[model samples]
Target: MSDLEATKTRYEVLGPLLDERLLRLWAAREARAIGSGGAYQVAAATGMSLKAIQTGLGELDLLEALPDGLPLTPVPGRRSNGQRSQPRVRLPGGGRKWTEDKDPTILPALELLLADEVAGDPMGRQRWVRSSLRHLSERLAAQGHSASPTTVSRLLKGLGFSQKSNKRKLGAVGRCPERDAQFLYIAAQRQTFTAAGLPIVSVDTKKKELIGNFRNGGRSWCRSAPEVDEHDFPSKAVCQAVPFGVYDVTKNAGFVVVGTSYNTPQFAVSAIARWWQAEGRDAYPGADRLLILADGGGGNGSRAGAWKVNLQERLCNRHRLTVTVCHYPPGCSKWNPVEHRLFSQISKNWEGQPLRSLDLMLGYIRGTTTRTGLRVSAELDDATYPKGQKVTRDDLGKVSFKPHADCPIRNYTISPQIADQQA
Candidate 1:
């Protein structure tokens, strides 16, 4: 066909004689078989190549003017494509929403405004974007561009920017309420120390730093250490992990003690003893009983039956906080929100920054914070931690903790030294 005939084929239904490049190319070519036109004649009428007309016919814009209620063909077997080829749209439930044609340029501006407004405030609620767009489009008439506010709004919505007030809203709930509730619960628990005429404080040493050469959890080993055969080599280069602790259920308060050695009961008890003298004492003024919620694994883990024995005598007896302990379920230490709310922030704030100096680590730990708060008490324990010293069972007998009626539930202990020194 001649190019004119090719273009004319597009709008044949409108009339073969009404072929004009500007109108057909702009309006009629926006459809594939739209307004009862065939693609071949559309190329002839619009002067577009038959190939260009054919190519544009399948696009969504071409069919924009088609009546929405028109019957459509059913493509079958989509799910199980063979015997299951069936009328899918007629199948119900998740059918598409029926809507009107909209402008494309309006969508970009709408989305830009919505996203710009939503960036700092995820709760969404920015109506100014829609209002401003409508105003701008209306004012454009004075500036000589023709468009309506309603039309602008429709285009904005089509681009996924909500003209309706619903788009900018936050999720059904935010973390603040839940976190506040938790703080309140923990605060109540802290008060129990007074109810029982005891002083209760959340106590655990911050993860310890090694005083000498040692392996760290994040090491880039040639092979997994756990997979290494016992015969392969000695696992000797392990650095000591530091111990971190919070007090009185206060996310805003806590401290860390750097230990020169951690392999022995003396190192563990001494570090803890120092921590108590430093911060724990201040948490409970005019207090009698000292209840500690500790995991069952660390220096004080139930397994370290000896550490508890030492704490009972050397630590608690000296302070006179009627110390009783409890332990959490095994392998579940992270359930302690303090780790993330407190310790995790500390680690994150300090990553890539070296703990090259003892004071540096102390500085970072004290600076850690959350939406709740930050606090840290730290001291360098340079007096030798007396490694390789073992406290015997006879020594355990000398250490005495004022017993709790329900020791298991009231006081917990844990001591699986972390794989991560900073954890």
Candidate 2:
């Protein structure tokens, strides 16, 4: 083959395997191996700039002058000893300098813009920019700082800033002063009950779902997308599915009762009672005490007198077990284990799938499992529970309730009442 063709063929074989430095050196070596005007020929064949080839030739000349047996500049390819040479891709401080270094005021301008509408802890080292990168870029440009959105992103990252969505962390309006104290008390109760090997359950009624062909919030793999109703009208629904979950903290198990009836205190207590009969008793054999973690609002809410009365009748007296109830602070229901562990998994499993029937909803709950060996069981309760059922003072007084010294409203115990127990 001709010299140019030979050079082109060699480069095609080895160019992809070499970095910038190695490519330049290889091109220079090939040019030198050829006679005069070899640089022009190599350049035409390999498409390398003449300056790079000349730089490589200069490096070769320097290498020739150096003494033998001294450590040489590392080469890119494998050595005679079968170990690969570790070489610098470029010398230190090589390549284009960063945008911040080029324009010192760019960082300050970015920070000023971030501070204008910053969210999150002001004192935190890691903060996020509220403005989009494009908007920030435009703002910086208007202020005489020439920066692209990509460059602005890099600079923001260097300054411990990132793009983040709004986190649902802040509490609802009128933050309760006793919120922190209630959390601490709940932690203590968990520790005490866990140490004694008693069953501790986190209970909550999940958001009621309309039973029928409805649009679920997530995507799933299917041959064709399932058609659902355009509008989620209650009148269009066949029924509503209210899933009351009891999550066993120690066992990492879940018991969900799907009720078609109203989510009243009676239904909530009956769900717990069902869990105790189906799984709790068998799991914690001979245990006489139970701990329940619930939210401050709902059918099993701390302030629901009927909730306490039902626990006294169904769980405490009927089962002969002492039930200690702890309610999470207002607007803190997400911290409840049932919400994340059991309910979240069930939501994920059934996402994009229409709950066309009560059976389908129960099936999704029953099939839900987690990587942490979580097992779930679900049952359907077609029984009717009318809402707004009030507990009289006489009935509430008969609960044999004992409020704890700390956060009595959120923490209390209901012991089994004797046959002749006084109000």
Q: What are the lDDT scores of the predictions, listed in order?
A: 0.49, 0.85
Worst 10 residues of 2 by lDDT: 116-125
* Candidate 1: worst-modelled 10 consecutive residues by lDDT: 116-125
Task: Kindly report which residue stretches of model 1 are placed more than 4 angstroms away from their true locations once superposed.
Answer: 1-191, 194-199, 205-241, 387-389, 401-423
* Inter-residue clash pairs, candidate 2: none
Give the winner by TM-score: 2
Question: In candidate 1, residue 248 scores what lDDT?
Answer: 47
* TM-score for predicted model 2 compared with the true structure: 0.65
Clashes of each: 64, 0
Those runs of model 2 whose alpha carbons end farther than 4 Å from true positions after fitting are 1-171
Please, what are the lDDT tens digits per residue for candidate 1 over residues 1-423?
Answer: 754554445445554444333333443345443454555445445555665454344323434555788764333223654554433323343434432323334444444334312211111222234137666576555545456777666655654445444445454333332333333343344556556655454445556554222232332334534332223122332334465454544325666666555545555566666766776666555655555655546665656756766665566656654555544445334434345435555666554443445666668667766555566666665555554446687764454433333333334332222224212
lDDT of 2 by residue, 1-423 (tens): 999999999999999999888898899999999979999999999999998898788777767877998887654443548876565576668777988888988888887676324423311223444468899899999999999999988887886667767567564457678977887788789889989999999899988999998898888999999999999999999998898999998999999999999999999999999999999999999999999999898899888998988899888889999999999888667667777667778888988899999988888888988777999999999999998887899998788899999999999999998878833
